[model samples]
Target: MKAQPIHTIRLILIPFTLEITKTLMAGDTSILQQLGLQLTPYWPDQEAIDTFPKIIHNLEKVPEPNGFESYMVVHRHSMTVIGDAGFKGLPNTEGEVDLGYAIITQAQKNGYGLEVAQGLVNWAFQQTNVKAVTARCLLANVASARVLERLGMQQVSSDAELIRWKLPKPVTQATIK
Candidate 1:
């Protein structure tokens, strides 16, 4: 089954399907119209554009969107595509999935990163097979590191160029009747 859109108070995470990925790569904004989404002129910035092919590759791996691939980050009230976020793929043998997100420059510093990351992390942990969510950011990207830290992800490792983070599933206690 296709994964459904994930809704948060101020944003909606719409999973990228093959059609959407192709349309995006082709520089066609008509898909946005069809989906009732608005696009900012600054969106699909170089970084976001560069990730399209990878997103398409991931989408092709499954018959449909499995919620483990990329998603368009749409602003709730404006219905605008402000960014993109999601996992690299389904959970690994270790039950861990890698997370990634990028907000358009115009939408930066507004907490959208944290909001979307929280939503994505929460969604991943809800899956029976997901035991941990992982992410990596450039060592120089302080803002991105802040978002991961805000989500309670701990620094698992770091190299000269990148810092890796991990958030283990939060344990929950069963309620007694």
Candidate 2:
């Protein structure tokens, strides 16, 4: 079965089904029409294309999408695929799921990156197995850093080239009882 989409105010995040990924890898535009989404000129760019093998490998493990892989970021108003975002894989033993996202050049600076990242983090936190959501951005990527900060992720560590951020699940009254 296909995973249900995660809807935001201005975007709908559709998980990449095996068929969808395979079609996308093959450079077919029919998947867009089949999903009722319009295609942007820059979507499924080189990076997205390069990641297909891994996405496909991960999706193939389950009988269906289980909400732990890539999702195409669709603009709600235009119904166009602007980019992709999703968890790297299932939560680790430490219960952390890595997050990654990118908005196409045409869609950047419109706050879609933050909206989709926030949506993905929110969804991951709701999962019982996820204790925290983690992400890494290049040192020079100020935009991504700002988005992570806005999402309430604290800087946990950094190296010469990359900075890591993590957001832990908030404690609730129910959890303390």
Candidate 3:
């Protein structure tokens, strides 16, 4: 079955299919138009291109629901592809998953990062066996650190080069008599 699209406050997270990834890797915008998504000039960045091979490999090994791959982040208002974000892979034996996100340069500083991160974290926690989400960023990426912090993630570890953050699943209360 095809993966379902996830909706956030201002964006829609659509899982990337092999065809779509290939088209994106080729720097084709026709696919976006065919998909009825608006075109944005900031996507298909070098990082996204560099990561496609890994993404394809992962997808071939473990398909959706089992594989954590990149999702195209589309702006709800403009229906444009703004960037990409997702987990590195399925939750581990410890119920922990790694998260990654990037908003195109044009879309940066617009709070889309926070919204996407929060939405992904919430979705992960809802999945079976997922207890926490973790993320790591370069020490110099203050913007990314802020996004993680806004998601209520705490700094679990850090070194001179990178900072690791994690957010545990939220508690749900049961009604009592």
lDDT of 2: 0.90
List where candidate 2 sits over 4 angstroms from the true fold: none
lDDT of 1 by residue, 1-177 (tens): 578999988999999999988988899878898999886687778888899999999988899998999999999999989999999998999999999999998889999999999999989988988989999999999999999999999999999999999998888773212
The collision pairs in model 3 are none
Candidates ranked, most accurate by lDDT first: 1, 2, 3
As a TM-score, model 1 comes out at 0.96
What C-alpha lDDT does candidate 3 achieve relative to the native structure? 0.83
Q: Output the number of the TM-score-best candidate.
A: 1
Q: Any runs in candidate 1 off by more than 4 Å, and if so which?
A: 174-177
Q: What is the number of backbone collisions in each predicted candidate, taken in the order shown? A: 0, 0, 0
Q: Which has the higher TM-score value, candidate number 1 or candidate number 2?
A: 1
The candidate maximizing lDDT is: 1
